[model samples]
Target chain A: MNTVFFLVFGLIVVVCAINVVVQRHPISSAISLIGVMGSLAIIYLQLGAEFMAAAQIIVYTGAVMVLFIFVIMLLNAGSEEGGKGPLTVRLLGVPLLLVFLGLLSYLIQRLFSDTGPVRFGDFKGGSPADVGRALFSTYLLPFEITSVLILIAILGAIVLARKELD
Target chain B: MPAAVPLSWYLVLSAVLFSLGVAGFFFRRNIITMFMSIELMLNAVNLSFVAFSFQLKQVSGNIFAFFVMVVAAAEAAVGLAIILTVFKNRATLNVDRIDSMKY
Candidate 1:
């Protein structure tokens, strides 16, 4: 029953994700992206991670996607007309994708054959409390560095976006 | 109640989603769509991380997901701001045409 549940939602996410790329209009792509993220949140719920599922919906689908849509609207970006460039891009991508797929398949087979089952000894009973401790303790430096990186990205984005005053 | 699903199922789904995101990143022309594609890729990886954490019964995945959320937030704010500015100046947001900064 649960397998069926995951399979169905997973298929839906795949379809919507493809739509995110195939749609000609940016708004439609955003809509499809929302659908994809929402389904992913549902998958997280079925996996027994309520907090993650909520964050999936609230952060990505709710906040980030809305921001994307707002930018699209503000830009008034018109639907891309059928054009030669996109077609050429697609044509070039196909073979490269095939090569990557082959390489990834080989790597997966190699990893499983060599490693047997992964050892997850320390990962059991995962909880928000555990996450909090790990973040502030073992992973503290990485966390702080990531914060600094985000700050730099914000500052850089502002610099890039600022209009030159005449 | 039924046959148990293996952890590999979730991993496979994540891989598929990640690949689709990659395809979108390469194929899409609009900058916003490209950014959305990047977000998709990030979320797909997060799914795999959470799945592995679940299978291992650890909290590291949850913590990583939290960090990913922070980065995604920052990316959204900065990325959208840049997009808005590009549109205001160029009056277009197509990725191919924004080569003004290039020498």
Candidate 2:
């Protein structure tokens, strides 16, 4: 059951990830990346990073992806077709990518076949409470700093994107 | 009674995703799509962190991944804003056309 779920979600992630790269329209790619994030959230759950899984869905898929789609719509970006890129990327990239991935998979399978496989219920410490405790205790400073950083980002984005007034 | 997926499988998945992100970053023509590829690379690294955290039984990796996500959000905001400014000035999103700095 665990393997089956992993296979399904992993397949979804891989397919959507490829679609994210290969799609002609930025909007289509944006939507496909959302699919990747959704499936990745499930993979995170399986790995016992419950808090990260939730964050993946909420922060990443929800806020970040929405921001991406908004930009895509606002810009009125269209599908690109061989838009004067280097000849290598325009011609050889796709096939080379496939072969490179095949080699990588083969290498990884060869290297780590002895370790124990991932099993659910093996990890129990990924609860929200545990993450909160760590966040407030050991990582308190970085957490606070991140909030300030987010504030700065918001201000900068607003400043840069606002219209010029005469 | 399904078999457990090996730890290497997850790591391998991360590797593949990262490579795909790199491919997109190199191949795409639009700036937004390239930015999405950067996001993909970040996500792949986050996955690697979480997988290692599971392997080592430490929460530190998860914390790092969380930080990466936060930084990525900031990057996306500033980046998209810059893209908007560029579009307003130049009226084009194709990366090849925005080479005013290439003097």
Candidate 3:
């Protein structure tokens, strides 16, 4: 059951990830990355990280992707120029990547076959309440630091992106 | 209950995504695309972290993953700002074309 779950979302993530890399247009890549984020959120939920799943959707797909799209539109960056690199490199790279993936999957299966299966309800320690408690307690310092960092980022982005007065 | 997926499968998926990110970073010519690739790589690592959190039955892995997200968000904001500045000066987004800094 869980294998089927992973297989579906995993395939979606891989394909969309490839799309993000292969698309010439930045907008298209941004959309594909949003797809990747959605699927990864599903996988995160399957792994019992419910809060992370929600955060992944809300942050990565919703906020970050919107930011990307806004930048793309603002910049008016059309599709990339064609013929990015040599024909030989493009022709041979696909097959080489296939072989690499095949080898990696084989090795991973061989190594983890005996590590037992991962059922849906394996470890349920990733709830929001748990994460919140941890965030405010053990990880409090980092949380505060991150807030400060975000403020700095906002300031820097505004300063750099705004039109010059002079 | 039905048979579950192996833990390794999740790890393998993460590895595959990370490889694609690396490929994008290397193959793409656009600066924004390259930055997107880096985000993809960060996401792949986040998946791995959550997977390991499940494996170890600990909350710390998720904590680490959260921190990674925070860092990535910060990086993206600052990076895009810098990109904006570069575009203002150079009038292009192509990595190869932005060669004024070269020796």
Task: Give one digit per residue, the lDDT tens place, for model 3 in A58-87.
Answer: 888888888888888888999987636667
Write down the DockQ of candidate 1. 0.49
Report how far off residue A97 is in candidate 3 (Å): 5.7
lDDT of 1 by residue, A97-123 (tens): 767756665665565443223222323
Give lDDT tens digits, candidate 2, residues B34-103: 9999999999999989888887778888888999999999999999999999999999888888997997
Q: For model 3, how does the per-residue alpha-carbon lDDT over B1-103 read when each residue is reduced to its tens digit?
A: 3468778889899889988998888789899999999999999999989998998889898888988988888888888888888888898888988876796
> Which CAPRI level is candidate 2?
medium
- Candidate 3 backbone collisions, by pair: none
- Number of the top-ranking candidate, with lDDT as the measure: 2
List TM-score per model, in order: 0.83, 0.93, 0.91
Scoring only the A-chain of each prediction against the true A-chain gives TM-scores of 0.76, 0.88, 0.85
- Backbone clash pairs in model 1 (N, Cα, C under 3 Å; residues 3+ apart or in different chains), count: 4
**What's the best-to-worst order under lDDT?**
2, 3, 1
**On a 0 to 1 DockQ scale, where is model 2?**
0.69
Who wins the DockQ comparison? 2
Candidate 1: which stretches are off by over 4 Å? A86-88, A102-106, A113-124, A144-166, B101-103
Evaluated on chain B only, candidate 3 has a TM-score of: 0.96
